[model samples]
Target: MSFVSEFRSFIAKGNVVDLAVGIIIGGAFTGIVNSLVNDVVMPVVSVVVGGIDFSNYFFPLNSAVTATTLDAAKEQGAVFAYGKFLTVIINFLILAWIIFLMVKGVNKLRAAEEKKPVEAAPAPPPADIALLSEIRDLLKNR
Candidate 1:
């Protein structure tokens, strides 16, 4: 086949297009999870622990990375973002918990299905026994 034809076929079937859509949705989902972790959950946590932005919470490594907080490190062109890492870790933990609950619900449904009783088919009578009963009836001369 020609290269154009193959390329056209690849585009027509839509695997690549589907992948692009999936990537876009995944990006959006990540943004939502990140916001939930950084904005909503963390603030609630901060209230309990005297209000601190964990994303801005970090330690300075050296003088090259000037400034006291994580924002300063980035301002002076520092490579470290330990606070970002912590925020990501928090997101991962929350996502993991949500996934665990979904899986647990699926398992419970599977268990309920398994617990359901299966019916057994009735047994057929033996041909020899049926024949013997017929012969006995004949002998009795009904």
Candidate 2:
């Protein structure tokens, strides 16, 4: 096969198409999760934790940097951004939890579908054999 045809064939496969669709949906889902974390959850957490913005929390590595915010601190010198890391870790945990719940629900639905009862098909003997068996029984009775 030609290179172009081979490439086309590979892309036309169901698994590859499904994988591409999954990647697109996953990217969109990530955006939603990020918004939920940054806009909603973090705000509530900040309120509960004395209204401190974790993104602005960082340690200056050098005395030259006297900035209070993380952005200014970075501009002044090297700094450890553990607070931002913590925020990111929180986002990851929330995303993982949402995915876990979704997977669990899907698994439950699949289990329910699998648990459905299936009727078994019945098999009948040949008419000649059945007749022979009946005759034998009648003769034995006589």
Task: RMSD for all candidates, in order, please.
Answer: 9.9, 8.2
Q: Per-residue lDDT tens digits of candidate 1, residues 1-142?
A: 9999999899878788998896897688788888899789888888898876677866655668767677767777655677678778989998878768877999999999999998878776699988999999999997
lDDT of 2 by residue, 1-142 (tens): 9999999999999999999998999899999988888899888999999998988889888899899999989999999999889789998999899889999999999999999997787777899999999999999999
Candidate 1 wrongly placed segments (more than 4 Å): 1-29, 119-142
Per-model C-alpha lDDT, please? 0.81, 0.92
lDDT for predicted candidate 2 compared with the true structure: 0.92
Instruction: Highest TM-score: give the candidate number.
Output: 2
Report residue 79 deviation for candidate 1 (angstroms). Answer: 5.1
Worst 10-residue stretch by lDDT in candidate 2?
Answer: 117-126
Once fitted onto the true fold, the runs of candidate 2 whose alpha carbons sit more than 4 angstroms away are: 1-3, 119-142
Candidates in order, TM-scores: namely 0.58, 0.75
